[model samples]
Target chain A: MRRRPGIGGLQKAAAARDQYRLLGENVAKLRTDMMKEQLATFRSQLEEFARKHKNDIRKNPAFRAQFHEMCAKIGVDPLASNKGFWAELLGIGDFYYELGVQIIEVCMLTRSHNGGLISLQELCNHLRQRRKKDREAVTEDDCLRAISKLKVLGSGFEVITIGKKKLVRSVPTELNKDHNQILELAQGQGFVTVEEVQRRLSWTSGRVTDALETLLEEGLAMIDNGHKDGKCRYWFPCVSSVYSSIGSDP
Target chain B: MASGSSIGVGVLFENAEVTTSGRPVLRRNEVECFLLSSVEFDSEDDPPRFTTLKSGNLILTTHRLIWIPSQSNGAVPSSISLAAVTHIYSHKKSIKSMFHSPRIRFQADPGAIVVTIVFRGKGDIDGFLTKFWECWRGRAWEEEEKSESETSRSGSGTVAQGLYGNDGTVRMVGLAGILRKEQEQWESTDKSLQDAFQDLNALMSKAKEMVSLAEKMRQKLLSAPSSQNGSTDDEEMGSKEEMQQWMLSVGIISPVTKESAGALYHQELSRQLADFVRIPLEQAGGMISLTDMYYHFNRARGTELISPDDLWQACTLWEKFDVPVMLRKFDSGVMVIQNKSHSDEEVMSRIRMLVTKTETLRAGVTASDAALTLKIAPAMAKEHLLTAETKGLLCRDMSPDGLRFYFNLFPEIDPTSQHIAKDFGTYGVWVKATSMLSV
Candidate 1:
């Protein structure tokens, strides 16, 4: 104000630097250093978060008990709700599974929760327990590209805006036959995170998180992310329930 | 010895005419009938051997006999005309002459070098002789000379109309005097027509003669009304003038035929057809059908008509000549003669603009409609339309209204998916173009 270089000039210079940094960061985050050892840690922490948040279990004890019994019959722990847990259970690391799981979780979460304008970054955070060095923001372009790929690979997921920022959701139908695999993997390994579904549905350039958002828009599953580490999660109500209520995307 | 005898220097052989292609220019109304190839000419009394014209072709026309060097697969075209063949000596039946190339001895003036026609190639001698007799006897030039005399006489009379009478008597320049002269002319014409139709056979033979008669009467009538100071109605005069013009243009310069073109029949016939087609080819806008020209050409030829096969052979001969007109065959098996400079690109561009227009797009265009716009015959216009369709510049709409053409939209249509137009596209233009229909 006192005759230094004008404020606009200073702001422009700062914005240029910030843009350069943002490009570098996004390019770096696009790299997938997917390793079994690294994924095992993300899996256990994500599972613990989902297990600790038992509001649905407390509210519907009969259903929770039935879910556990089903998991027992399937020979998998119901509390193992992390994406890696599901991927290991299915022996897959692709992102479509994570996306499908994320969409289902979002639908479930939206039924009981309201955090206005769910941003992709906030959703991604809810899907994985990220390290301080790994907290990259999800971009609109990233989300768009990922959802497009999920549509191509026959994933029944969608990304939508509720209150403004795009949030992951599921299509109201499971007409996309490949989406049934998501339910199968989830049932076999208890539950999959939104991140796991997103990873399974990876397009040419889509990150795992974008895949999760798309699946939630399609209502084949349900999701939740209100936990300490913000690891968003998904659980199918029942395969028959989703199929009967939803129609295919022509 | 019949060697080099001419009455005077630089006489250059009597009344000889050659074609533009150096074959032989035909007299007006002359037609080529038949032709023979491989002939030599020498003198009966040991003249210098015109040696081995090696397959030289002889042509017989309605008017004169022609000799052309046979165009073997590849040979320089050389020719000579026989308008001066005044007499033919009786052939000597000696054993030596009989073994030689079937030769005929003929006497020609003014040199009177008893020239011998030696047929060195295989051909029908009686056929050639019959045609030679027919052409020599036809005396076509007599008619031309008579016509030319009448033309000169009429030309001189027009200049003499002011003061002198038909008998070269001086007359006063008055309207009444001119009217009396014109009336006398009309009465003469009326008398002739009455005499012409006296017998039905006379009338049939005199159809062309009637045309000439009408021409004479109309000329007489035209001068009459003007001298009478518009005594007759303008409409009657106008119709009469039109009828006269049609009758006057009823004659063709040359016609191709099998009778006149002896020995070299179709070859010379081909050249004559090529020359005669120039005017009609121009009128048809650089292209015309063979069938059509056959009618116009034969009508102009008068007595000698050509068959369709003769016309085709003539057209095919165009490839051998450096003429301006060429024969073109379309994919649909239609044949035509076109100027060498004619281009499909120009025709295609015209059709492109035609189909894209608003009215043409909606209503489409028929071959006749295109012909009218393109200023060409309907058949030729149909060929252009079909070619345009093949190039994908236009598409055809075949319905009860007959086959019509419209601008093609095949390229504009996206076959991949229902990805709608992206603001500026051929599809958008099409939509805007058709939007007027909606409003």
Candidate 2:
């Protein structure tokens, strides 16, 4: 109560500060303890729920999805360990783990053709082909989930989107905007001439040449000097070629 | 067992089981704190006669110090419990200590043995020592033991045997007994369900028990098919598996919610994202777009979904942490999470191999062709093809047949003598492959 600036007053102020610090520490510790307790209870209850509804969660996709949502909200990773209750009861761990392996096999087998890049739809098609005998349909969502788990191997595995299409990149090669632009433009005919790119992109000839030269150098583009117009065609192999109007009248 | 002399690798310290990947198996609730590579563990005694461990990774956890050899040619994974550590001798600052490799000495129990850790590789010796001291003083093992003992004590009291008959009721016999038991069980389940649905609060509390009933019903359905006939129907089995398959994905049970993590929300979220992205990244073949990640992450999170900005902020913050996954923005402004170890050189070499093939050389591989061969998306294949093109490993050929990529014969063909057939080069190979196709 003494509002004096003497030595005794300073000592009292220091003592009060120390008490406040102690109280704050105690409150923080209490809060952490409470949170830990809540987490423990949540975990136990979630385990019980999963155990009870294992069959339903496994059979009903929508219900299973809801349960997964619940698990996520509570921060429980059912797929964290294969030897756990989740694995024994649901076998969910092995399912995704096996999917991951299948994905790797698919990527490895197709690496020679796509240069380590494949469209999600194409990947799914290959996956379906491989899993023809398998009754359970592997959705793109499931693939994404399984692929997400493979990040532990490294960052070389990733999914990138180009012009509304999701493409899975197995390698670490980067594609610039200019390169992506040219590829997008080439998506229609699977080829773009330097003049066409210059007109469409409204870029200078230098920019177009640099982009086309890069694509050509990267083995992504092939030059067709044999064209009737005499205009050199930079063909992008990554874009699906539209050969419907060409010579197919066998 | 790989080598005769190295049989004593884990003789002195307790034998620690390692994973197939050579990572030391951790005790329940035990967490790794610090890791130092290229460390040697041996006795500090003169001649180091008893035990000698060389060229191993030293991992300091909350409970033990694990030593895993780089290559398992001979050495075994070994661990010393933190409880066994009696004293950690401070580094003696002298001219002698400065010249040699950084080392740490700590006296452990059992034989009161003095263990000397020689750091042959570059690492923070002081930091390791500090963590060592902290782990030792923390006594985390004792807490685990205490909790384990308490659980065992509580569990030992209950010894309920069998179903129904143990209560000393008039046990119905054979089929009648089974029917009665089923009836009672159903009644109990019905009551529990009714109680759960009484109100939202009641449902929340009984949620755990309520969900299990569905499983019981499914199990019954499964057993019904088996009981009805000796042979199982293919359609039923397929449907059952498919139903379960819907819920087969991994769920982050304990997502880092704002309520739980507070001010460390982004940091915790970043760490969790790093862990979460591993599977998807692997599936996507080591890279995934930010948009895809957001969808997957949110889908998993269910209700407590974060905003795009939040996800972006969390990814940007990954640079400050020692996470394995990183936020990579390409020149096209497309953001992706990639492993730090992903190498473009490997992809380039694969592309080089692809284009140089006789079939590909003749026809000129398109993005789809590359996608099929490379086992990647056409978009990604295009990126690689573009990259290969930029490296001058391949050339473009565009026509009515669309775009195609061929091995860059530009470098091998002499500009002055373009028509000359050099029998050895890629040009010659291409000519040979294409001529055969034309004929």
Per-residue alpha-carbon lDDT of model 1 for B182-237, expressed as tens digits? 45544444454455445433433443444444333334434444433345556345
* Alpha-carbon RMSD to native, per candidate: 43.9, 22.8
Could you report the DockQ of all the candidates, in the order they appear?
A: 0.00, 0.04
Residues A112-155, candidate 2, lDDT per residue (tens digit)?
A: 55545677887888777545444455678777876776564345
lDDT of 2 at B274: 79
Candidate 2 stretches with Cα past 4 Å from truth are A1-250, B1-63, B66-78, B82-108, B112-282, B285-287, B290-329, B336-375, B397-404, B414-419, B432-439
Ten-residue region with minimum lDDT total, candidate 2 chain B:
B158-167
> Per-residue lDDT for B1-439 in model 2, tens only?
2343344433446667864323456665565656777888777453333344688777777788888777665666778888888899998789998899988888877667788899898767787787678778878688668867875874565332112122344344654564456456445554665676564446555543444444433343344344344555674455354334335344554455554334446865786787788887888778776755765675455434565557888899888766777887755456788887764777778888887777667667777566656666455677777778888887887865556778887788788987888888777788888787667
Scored by lDDT, model 2 comes in at 0.62
The alpha-carbon deviation from the true structure for residue A153 of candidate 2, after best TM-score superposition, in angstroms, is 18
Q: Using lDDT as the measure, which candidate wins?
A: 2
Supply candidate 1's per-residue lDDT for B29: 53
